[model samples]
Target chain A: MELLKQRINKDGDIKEGNIVKVDSFLNHQIDVELLNEIGKEFKSRFSLEKIDKILTIEASGIAIAVIVAQYFNVPVVFAKKTDSKNLDKDTYESKVYSYTKDKTYTIRVSKKYLNKGENILILDDFLAKGKAAEGLIDIINQSNSNLIGVGIVIEKGFQNGGKNLRDKGIKLESLAIVDSIENGKIIFR
Target chain B: MELLKQRINKDGDIKEGNIVKVDSFLNHQIDVELLNEIGKEFKSRFSLEKIDKILTIEASGIAIAVIVAQYFNVPVVFAKKTDSKNLDKDTYESKVYSYTKDKTYTIRVSKKYLNKGENILILDDFLAKGKAAEGLIDIINQSNSNLIGVGIVIEKGFQNGGKNLRDKGIKLESLAIVDSIENGKIIFR
Candidate 1:
């Protein structure tokens, strides 16, 4: 976590409205070496949990989840943002509000992928408002699966998403927590 | 390669219109162990080449590309499917037509991640008509990056994408080539 924080400070760009851009290593352009370390961290934290599947949203979260799945020795199921021709007609769908995009989009996972009574570990790159995480949790609940825990690379501590999930008694572990961004500087908790 | 072909035959679904769905392993639900094998295979095939970076598209390709990047010890830059608020304005964009979706959409990659003269290896989950690969290649060319080769997990040999890229003198390696699917039987080349 210290390493992630250090890399974030060195490479991450702090934009207006407390936005942290970690494209250099975390999001846009991925650092596989760092991700493997993050995966090891996640594995160490939740290795005891009965995690049957690792779930994440498409685009960004897929990379982290796939790498982390290797540590957990589990299969990763990513929620598709759009209903593709190949996606199953019968899907567990939920709406995720993206503050950055200023809109809500439907996230879906096929019913065939999530079975009843399965233990799921949700992972993502960043947890801002927790809308995306909640949407993934919603899909899991709809499928009658158990939410083992949520693993995040970076959590915006100022945001309500992380707190809300913790308040609900859902097990949550964030590698790095950004408490606030003040005067174009990132403050870690 | 035989392992991949066997997994596909066991779990892959052959739907109407010659679609071979291997979402269980390649996409949707990703098997990291299998992906590790894939990554090693890709490394062995292109190990001699100087691949500076691994490039892929969002959603499906991100998982494979990230896992594959570990083998090349290179970073991965996935092309964003949409213009997000976080994505840089100055981007190398290209239009990709999805035969399955029956629509064309623009894919964008931040100019900062891809550098001129950098050798790039394009990785993808499936290569059908090769529209997606072509779109990625266009983005690479726009950024002045040299494409070392293309590594495809499954290439629809019946389709023209592989042929087209080969005709263009591009180095291409496909783990499994599906020649045809007849009466729910997948024929591999």
Candidate 2:
């Protein structure tokens, strides 16, 4: 976690609208080494319980989830952001509001993937407003699966997502939580 | 790739339009153990070259690329299909025509990721018409990078994409090459 915060300080860029772009390592161009380390950390944190599968969203979250899943020794199911012709017709759908993109989109997972009473761990790169995580949780609930916990690489602590999930008694673990981003400086909690 | 062929035969569904859906293991709901085996196989096949980075497209390709990068011990960079506000303004873009979806879309890579003279190994889930692979090659060319080879998990040998790349003197390695699909039977080359 310390390594992650330090990496964020060294390589992350603070843009307008409170966006901390870690594209150099985390998202766009990935650092598989760091991801391996993060995967190990997540495994240590959540290794006690039985996790049947890891779920994440499309695009950014897919890379992180797949890497972390290696440690959990479970399959990963990524919720599709769009209704593609390739996707299954019978799916559990939920709407996610992306404050950054300023739009709400439907996220779906095939009914075949999630089974009743199966434990699912949700992982992602960033948690800003927790909208994406909430959407994944909604889909998991619809499948009658047991919500294990949520693992995040970087959480925007200034946002209420972490707080809301904690208030709901959800076991949430974020490697690096950014408490504030002021004048291009990222302060971690 | 015998394991892959067996898995495909067992789980892969053949649709109406000659579409071999391996989403059960290769994409969508991904099997991490199978993906690890795939990463090892890809490393064994492409181990002779010095691969600096692994590149792929977004969504489906990201999971495969990241897992494959673990064996190579290099970073993975996926081309973004959509221009998001989060993406860098300066990007190397190429248009890819998706015959399956019946649409053409632009894929972009941040200029900072792909350096000149770097040896990049392009990895992807499928190669039907090879439009996606061609677009990735175009981006690599624009960046002045050396494409070591294109490694495909499944190549439709009946399609011209594999021939086109081979004709261009590119080292294209496909794990499983499907020659034909007749009445739900997949004939491998």
What would the TM-scores of all predictions be?
A: 0.98, 0.98
Q: Worst lDDT window (10 residues) for model 2 chain B?
A: B96-105
> In model 1, which regions exceed 4 Å deviation?
none
Docking class of 1: high
Q: List the lowest-lDDT window of 10 residues for candidate 2 chain A.
A: A80-89
lDDT of 2 at B6: 94
Q: Mind giving the per-residue lDDT tens digits that candidate 2 earns over B1-189?
A: 999999999999898778888877877899988888989999999889999999999889999999999999999999998778899999999999887567889999999999999999999999988999999999999999999999999999999999999999999999999999987799999
Worst 10 residues of 1 chain A by lDDT: A13-22
Give a tens-digit lDDT track for model 2, residues A76-107. 99999877777788999999988767788999
Q: DockQ of each candidate's interface versus the true one?
A: 0.89, 0.79
Flag regions of model 2 displaced more than 4 Å: none
Model 1, range A43-156, lDDT digits (tens) per residue?
999978989999999888999999989888899999999778998898999999888788889999989999999999999999988999999999999999999999999999
